[model samples]
Target: MFDRFKERTPVRDSLTFLEPNPMRILILLFITIATYAFAKEKMFGNGSLPAFLKHFDTNSDDLIDEEERQAIRDLRAKLREKRRTSIDLDQDGEISENEVSMARAALREQIEQRRLQKFSSIAGEDDLISREEYTTIPGVRNLPDFIFDAVWRRLDTDESGYISPEEFLSRLLKH
Candidate 1:
């Protein structure tokens, strides 16, 4: 090919060997710019893409070369490490959809259990909160043991052997 081209070198060669032919220079410049623009748009548009897939398909073939496949495996390992840190609550260094769901379910169950415990404490021994109970004691009110026994005795109006939770709350709050 070199033998085919004429030896009439231009003064512009001093600037760049490529500048000898303005058309050749323009064509080369165009090719370089087009290649850069295509590479940028096709591959790096979103940083979210897995690195291997971006570089593997220069000709746009779906399958990656062996080298690219190796690269992909390496990249996947690094990404998996990052993902494990992000989602693996147990810190086992592996991430799975089930683990994520399990973590969420555990948190929800904890919240629900706390809610049940809170409600149970509010109800105390009554099991159910009576309407008047909240009004009588807005906050925690200490009841003397003697007073409680006396009140219990009175609440067992029929002289039943024991006072039920309902009877106890009803009698205590009404007064």
Candidate 2:
């Protein structure tokens, strides 16, 4: 058995061109990185200021009007307020560093509890939900198949063919 292994080493070494060439590996790495960059650019919508200006410049006059500029400022303020609200879980208008994680966890827990309640209502006495059971649930059955499938699969995090109450609750809780 040892001799068989030893013989294969020489055979592998003799095939010099078949060996993984560093230059080829480097080229493949470069291609993979380039592909990733390209994909990310396409997948994430452009957020560049010029793109934003183009989008909001409705009149096509090559310049934004005072009203348009005000709209932009309002949009920026709204976004800022949204960020503050998200980080300030208690709605206290401020977010201290210590409260950051606690706030996040609190928000996630609240959302999870709501999801669990919904799942429990549909799960009946089984305490576990399969995809079919989920699709056939009265409130959910009305949803189109594609939409329901996507939501169900997302909740079935472990992909173990069922969604436990815990799994349903934590599916998108983020913590």
Residues 57-170, model 2: lDDT tens digits: 878775788988998779978987887787876777878886788877787788777877877887878889987777766778788878987987888878888899877656
Tens-digit lDDT track for model 1 on 75-153? 7689867755767876777767888898678777776667556546655685644433432444324566676556546
In terms of lDDT, the best-performing candidate is 2
The 10-residue segment of model 2 with minimum total lDDT is: 44-53
Off by over 4 Å in 1: 1-94, 134-175
Provide the global lDDT of candidate 2 against the true structure: 0.76
TM-score of 1: 0.26
Pairs that collide, model 2: none
Write down the worst ten-residue block by lDDT for model 1.
Answer: 131-140
TM-score, each model?
A: 0.26, 0.35
User: Which segments of candidate 2 are over 4 A away from where they belong?
Assistant: 1-69, 82-95, 124-127, 136-162, 170-175
Task: State each candidate's clash count.
Answer: 0, 0
